[model samples]
Target chain A: MDKTTGIRKRAWLLMFVVVALVTATCGNGADDTTTTAAAAATTTTAAAAATTTTAAAAATTAAESMTVAKVAVLVPEEPTDFGWNQQGVEGAVAAADAAGIESEVAGGLGYDAPTATLRQLAETSDLMFAHASGFATAAKEVAVETGVPVVVWGSPDDREPGLAAFVSTSAQEGGYLAGILAARTTQTGQLGIVISADDFNWTRHSGGFIEGACSIDPTIDIELVQIGEGGYADVEGGARVTAILIAGGADVILGNGDGSSFGMIRAVETEDPPAGADKVWFIDVIGDKTSIDTENILLSSILWDFQPTYLQAIRDVEAGTFGDVNYDLNLATNGIALLRTENISDELWAEIQTARDGIVDGSISVPAADTRAAAEQLLGCGA
Target chain B: MFDETLITAVLVGAIAASVPLMLAGIGELISERAGVLNIGLEGMMLMGAYGGFWVAIETESIWLGFIGGAAAGALASLVMVFLCVRWGLDQIVVGIGVLLGAEGLTSLLDAATFADTRPRIGITARLDIPGLSDIPVAGRVVFGEPYMVYVTLLAVAVAGWVLWKTPWGLAIRATGERPEAVDAAGVNVVVVRSLAVLSAGVFGGLGGAYLSLVSAGNFIPMMTGGRGFMAIVLAMLARGRPLLLAAGALLFGFATAGTTALQLVGVEVRPEIVNSLPFAVVLAALVLLGRNEFLPSALALPYVRGER
Candidate 1:
């Protein structure tokens, strides 16, 4: 009977430990709530402190006052890949340099790594720039915890409340420009597009390119290929797919993948030139390709400059005027531009310029591929 | 698109994917044949990849970067050897520790060295053999390859020959099968086992170099993507035979290539689902093969001079 009683007591103790563990796990959500509340309290206290200081300073009207704020820029990949992430790094550096603000830059923070790094930086920085769509979730979570504003780059979507704003170049306009270039350059009447994947972003660009090209010549054939599994990282896969397209008589090719575009460029570089022909033309995305000298290749590029948008956001943050709406930097805002060199014919240049003017003057509004309505209406395909 | 060219594409993808696995598998085969199971193959490959990529980026030469990667793998292996062989630690535990340490070290060092640095080495163009490259799909699949691919094939051939047709191979196998007998024959069992482990490290490191320098041309954290462990699986499936391992590696490569190809044909499968195919296939193979028991006798056993 005594042994049975001892066993029952031990069993009760084991149950208590299990309950404690379960409670601890459940308490994590409660702790998060408390942290947010604490952050809100701190924010209120800081506002009150600022109000008192301003009131006190009103008595000493002759005193000059200055405030210094620290800003941080975070990137998801290397800054020198001559592609996606590089643009963000360059933009942040240029903006910070111009404003003469003390800033720190962190790059190559993988999917979840950005949240931890951003949280650590939040303790010191007055504002943070989260520079990738993949980094948006973590940036939003950290912004809520720290009660600080975060400015993210990429097409605006359903973002958290603290995401002050989003800045992005109009991808559809860029695609339209690429289509105009491809239509003019194609000798076989068929232009090929090798994208990184079949994501909404790539589909928008490809759809716009196709529509723009067909607008110029209804019978023009446009073959769209995607390195579906590679996800913008597979250069070899891109090269192989590009080679196959070129072999299938695609005279002009346009690449929409960031780093994977290098593969397409290489494929064009290695292809044997026709007798008496100088080179084949290829269109570039994200950054300028006019500088890369390859015989008759690298004809034009669509350049997305984040400098103006990023600087404006920083200025707004410093002035304490951050807001929730996205700062759309479309072609109308001079955020996206079509860059062509003397290598392109003057006649073709005039044609592209007409479309550019039309976009800027609000005569043309390029639809994005994010919404079902836009995809169905613009792409003529149901989601 | 579904004509004879499709066959060529499949073959080419298989060969390309098999190169890294072949290198790492042959190394693991030798290491396991010597009775030291090194599960840190993946981590070691990652280290080599980052090291090779950084060196090549700084030196602007792929060859130097390849050497740097091999050295890095060897250094990582040396740590495993010290823990398992010298300190008499548990082989599996030591390997797990090494794997974790190498992974952490690679990520930390990659962040420190290559962060915000855009470093790329020009792809080594295909080597065209005069008449051989003109023959249908076989020509494009086999003849049109980078120099590293040729080296991998040669390494596999050489490894097979060395393991099955050499006296040193016999001694090494004997040490694994019966360390007492080999020690009684006056062979320095420690030296042979250490050399086997180090050679395995070199092969794994080369696999990493191929990934960082040749494949991606830039270092991404954890970029080996479990290829090292996959190589070990290939080694096991082949029963330590280099030629069979090559075949196994090609099977994995084809699975990956096919998954990508299917999506390109507008098969509308979620990418995450496709990515999981190769791993799932490997797990199934392991379970099925485990039931049949086609493993080396002394595969995971560590050698002790006088123990049973």
Candidate 2:
């Protein structure tokens, strides 16, 4: 080989090696921060082990010393989703504000194992809320390793004495209300349920919606379409899928997705209604999107307010009983409520309010369907 | 159980879905023909989607959004050209880096810019052909698409003709096949490949903007949703033929919309099976049509003058 060619090859090799080393160095620096936090947590655990004479005394000491100066939440999507992520962030912030403490949010983390992020947030925060069911396992591991308390969703069995807590929402109750509203509002006698995934919250909500619609009209058609297994942000998929349901004669759409709901709303706004209906209506879940409802097609939303439950978690932490009990959000607890919109008439609103009262007063029960099969059964799809 | 409206909707949805894939596949076909295997096409599409949506929201013009998206994609392709084509970096590694970088940057930008008030633009205008648009079922499916679809088809035809008919096309193919021979023949190999990659970026960017502007009418994080990778597969399967790429893209689109139609018709199959229908269709198509398909000899290889 020529000398110049050999030198050029060697220079390229050296450049690659240098770049690799720089990347490794940066990666190790971040690792060191996590390692230091883990080590500190181990030291604190050992110190706690050495000092306590009894469990009662230890609990007392923890209650007195554990200061919740700041709380943090981790969500899988951007906090502006106006759904699960936004509600989680706003709830944590509200809880912190209620306690006169600071709140830190680490959002758009995706559905990956955020172990490093958990440790980083744990370093500066007193309590961490992993705001997604997908995050439960990793959050629990990080909570145990870092000696920081974590709150996970839909994992009641993961709750420990002080390390991890579990919280859940009965979004189905609100979905039942939405179903009632949809049943009342639909002119085509058909409703659509579009879920982005086979999510626990979505299935339960769908089940409740089916039951509610059936309660008002036994033969009301409810067509449920799942966009994909993990189509949480698939806006186009959401739009086309909703279009299919609309073409099948569904005029009211009970749309459940993080960002894909916007697509459903868009379809409802843009598409022509089915044969008998004059307009298509959209029913959203989690957060309210009335501000962005420029088309005025949003009938209502099954609103979820996490503030009460998050505040209770904070109170539990302060009382040294953080993970001792699991939290459940229900209509009775005021954790979930149906949003009132101008599209609903006074008489229909009165009927929805009565249904809500019945649910809270133990006269009505929203069926819990946590799986696709169970939800389909509730809709009589099996029949 | 499929009624007229349902049939029309499925057909319309299928065609709408195919447009982005066809545009991206055609672009990737051009790049592959020039011997630059762009594994970073997904990133370019994503950046285009973001850039396009941002421009559309700001200027309130969908056409300007498409242009902005193409420019953003071209801007992204410069990285691939500089690092892989010129500097001879590992194409796969650089492409993967581009994908990761685009995903993170777009997500961050969307959160930072539109977190408070998520904005959505109106759908683009459709050019319904006066005569064809009045026909039963076929009219809406063929003639009722946005004007961009026609432009994309025209672009595909032009690209195919240029790749086969023009001297510039010969230079691009020669660069991919025999860079040394091209260099000996007084053609700048790097320039040819760079131009090909830039064209790919524009195409991919246009596809992404179509998703955000024409299809969804909104920008969401990771909104391209693996369509970029799907385009890569279509391009590869098409074997450098633009027309075949269009067919493969339409096949995928039809399968996607057909799955929804089946579910809506109360076809009580497992969702896993239903969702896999599109991919199964592609796999079947690949098996049937992808016989003796050959890629460029120097594809993904960095060409340095006077070096093996």
Candidate 3:
């Protein structure tokens, strides 16, 4: 209320943030580390104004930090579409529940300035999960100002000890498995990769897919096309590109997009198969659309489940090592996986499992491709 | 690679993609010519998409869906009419509000109804032109297209005729150039602008309906994906020429399909640059042609009846 009181509150807040950072960065996920940080946060909150100096000194100790009781996740869309936004929101909620904390979903925030929402969520939330890659900049700033540990995406370099952590999808492994499935399933020996955007994640998938497909038969024709620079939601564009891919004699299609995946599926549905093929098959990336696959063309999906990854982030905070790790969703970690449906026969599933095991065991090295050129090099496209 | 079948398919795909932009662009050109710069075309299209999808699903009639979509978009334009046209508010701000409002409302309605079903519409049956439909390649693509494609072309032609060959066209142009002069001429400037904006909304809505019912087969959130903005750019670059607007929209569509063609044939190029080729090439052509100079002088300015 008064100037001195306001100054004391500010000093107390600073002490808590510094203490949390120091404790988190120094300790491990041991019993003592959790107790020390939790106790420090509890003690500082109890008498922040009266003992600001003591609290500041206490916070510097390796074991002293704040207890995160609640976590909040922000997304640009509602979690009902069973896709990226839905998966992110649901994963955050699941992670919070696993971490024994309260979860707040700030969904449907739109692709705009999220500084206001991040700030508001930071006030009450201990760790803010900025789900969308678009929220990375604003979330990092909010974390610094509010002392909240924020999880952002796109750049692993953005991770700061006790402040912000980056999470990215390791789609290469799943892409490899998808490639294997396509190679084994396709009667025509032609595979398609329809990318909805100029995304590095998809490039990685393309690389792995091409490698896996070529590994089966070196001369297998692989057609790949991109919708546009930012065609994440370009459903019509996805459909049209997919049709072109089909026309190029691709019977097995691997589609990577958010909403555009549905269009790819639709294109596959409308298109009659080429010679030596019975029906067109589509392999989707990220989130399963098995429920909406009325045409029965969906073979599988490269699923990215962020719950375990998010839970590990909470565990890092508990051990005072939140921002020390670049969280990844990979096949080895079961973060990235291939979806199975009735379309995948039992024998194919067993074969796919063997490949998955190989990837996890490090026996099969699925090289990462972060660009179309790199992917073409790996897949031998145009070579 | 450029075989007749592939070329036909590519051309057909380009037409499907360009139809929506053509409708939205020609409508935007009329509105800008009448002095109202609408940034809410995206919202109008989005709302129209939902309206059309819902009606089509309910009635199992694609035509009804188109009409419903246009009506919904025109209805949504009432906000612009009352705010910018009547009360003379900031056109850009009101346009943004309308966009946001449409997004929220459509998303909410969709979640409530279609979230579970995720209903998809198949391509509507083509309106086969008697003998024209039998021709090779071009026949199936041009004459075998659904009725909406013909209506879109007719709408553009009609818009051009009204804008260039009618007294109303003179009044609309005069309103954009010198609204005070149009008022002195005893023609209500507000009424002209209102009609222009309303027509734009109608065109945008119909385009959205086609996008959902025929192009995509379903409505997804933000399905328009800045196409309304692209239409705005096309309209500005067309220099008030409807045919040029159609050409610009088709050029963009072909450029998009070209990326697919290049990649499918195993062309080893930067896919990122390839993906952006449509906008980059279209905008470059517009700049080379010096068409942006034709932008309406009084665009985005809210005119009070008596004030300068």
Q: Which model scores highest in DockQ?
A: 2
Worst 10 residues of 2 chain B by lDDT: B268-277
lDDT tens digits by residue: candidate 2, B1-308? 57777887787777777898988888888898888989999998998898899999899999999999999888888999999989989899999998898888888888777768988787567776788865666676677767998999898889889988999988987888889999999999999999999998999999988888877777788888888888988887777888888887777777788887887666644546744555566577667767433677888889999887
Which of candidates 1 and 2 is the stronger one according to TM-score? 2
Quote the true-contact fraction of every model.
0.12, 0.52, 0.40
Q: lDDT per residue, candidate 1, A1-383, as tens digits?
A: 99999999999999999999987855663466534432443344446563433322231221112122667888876564566767777777677777887677887775557777987777666667898777777775555545556786544663333334666556778777777777877777777777776555566667667666766777776666666544575555566566555544566777777667765676666543322234556777767645444344787776677777777777766554554456755667666767777768998999988988887786866666653224334432221
Model 3 chain A poorest 10 in a row by lDDT: A55-64
Expressed as tens digits, the lDDT of each residue in A1-383 for candidate 3 is 59999999999999999999878854542345424444444445545462433433443333127577888999886666667887888788999998889999997787688999987786677788898878898887556544578899758778777777898877899998899899998988889898877677888899889888877778888867888777777888888888777766689999988777767777787654766899999998878888777678889898989999999988887788877788889997888999998988899888889999998999999878888768767755435
lDDT of 2 by residue, A1-383 (tens): 69999999999999999999988865675577645545645544556663322333333344345767889999998788889999999989998999999999998788886888998898788889999988899887677666678899856788877777898878789888988999999999999999998898899889989888888888898888888888888888888888778877899999999888877887787665888999999999999999888778889998888899999888888778888789888888888988899999999999999999999997998867888767877775334
lDDT of 3: 0.80
Q: Which candidate's TM-score is highest? A: 2
**Which ranges of candidate 2 are over 4 A from the true structure?**
A1-67, A381-383, B128-136, B181-187, B265-293
For candidate 1, the TM-score is: 0.79
Chain A TM-scores of all predicted models: 0.76, 0.86, 0.81
Clash pairs for candidate 1: none
What is the RMSD, in Å, between candidate 3 and the native fold over all Cα? 7.9
lDDT of 3 at A20: 96
lDDT per residue for candidate 3 within B226-286, as digits (tens), equals 8888888888778677888898888877766775687656664554564465567657876
